[model samples]
Target: MKTLSKKDIKQLNERIGREVFSKKDLLQEECGRYYRNKELVFFTLPQGRLAPSLKFLLKDLYLPKVTVDMGAVKFVVGGADIMRPGVTACDEGVMQGDLVVVVDETHGKPLAVGEALMGSEELLAATSGKVVKNLHYVGDDLWNA
Candidate 1:
């Protein structure tokens, strides 16, 4: 585990286009640390990039999200890729290659973070096949980490 310095936090905030942690949050609470292991991988969220763990922690805040039907929840939490047929809704402005949080329709809780394989319009129009490449999901090593 490695704690992020104030400079690192500032750089991360700039890269993500939002302040993820205040100095107090990091210094006082010791919350800005990166954990890495064979099962869990940690890295900075690159400029304009999003990670599943970050999305999960900030779900209450505004973020682009994709909703999958309940039937897909099991597969998603198991780290299976998202399929267009299972997607029930998507936030507007989600373009191809965008980072997206995957949530179940029942409770609207994030289940995974993924890269959009298609734009929102294309995702909604498709009737079948994969739509998002699952990067992280509930019950995965990152979640446990």
Candidate 2:
């Protein structure tokens, strides 16, 4: 692990559009290049964009949310893409390509982080199809890392 310089932390804050933990708390893992603070971990996605791990997102709770029914919990935790039928609610401002948290409706606990396949309005209006593409979840490599 390596401590991140102030410059690196500043750029990360810019990329995520907000200030995060202080430099003293931020470390970059050597193996996966994942960024870690005292509280959470995040990493670059396959699309080459930075994204928070599901655990990090739970602590931060800043992403727009896609709420799913209890029935969908199993599939969601298993890394299945979110299907329209299982979605119970969505934050209004979500847009296509936006990062969103997938939460269980019952407890409002985040289950995964995904990229929106459709806007919130469209996702709620649709009947049956894959909507959000699951990118990170509880048992995924990122979570383990």
lDDT of each: 0.72, 0.85
Backbone clash count, each prediction separately? 0, 0
Best by TM-score: 2
Q: Please, what are the lDDT tens digits per residue for candidate 2 over residues 23-92?
A: 6665775543556654346777766787787777777899999999999999999989999999999999
Candidate no. 1 TM-score: 0.80
lDDT of 1: 0.72
Clashing pairs in 1: none
Q: Per-residue lDDT tens digits of candidate 1, residues 1-145?
A: 4555788767756765776556554322123324322222233344425353733344343558899999999999988999998999999999998888898899888888888999999999999999999877888756776
On lDDT, the candidate that comes out on top is 2
Per-model root-mean-square deviation over C-alphas: 4.7, 1.7
Off by over 4 Å in 1: 27-61
Clash pairs for candidate 2: none
What are the TM-scores, per candidate, against the unseen true structure? 0.80, 0.92
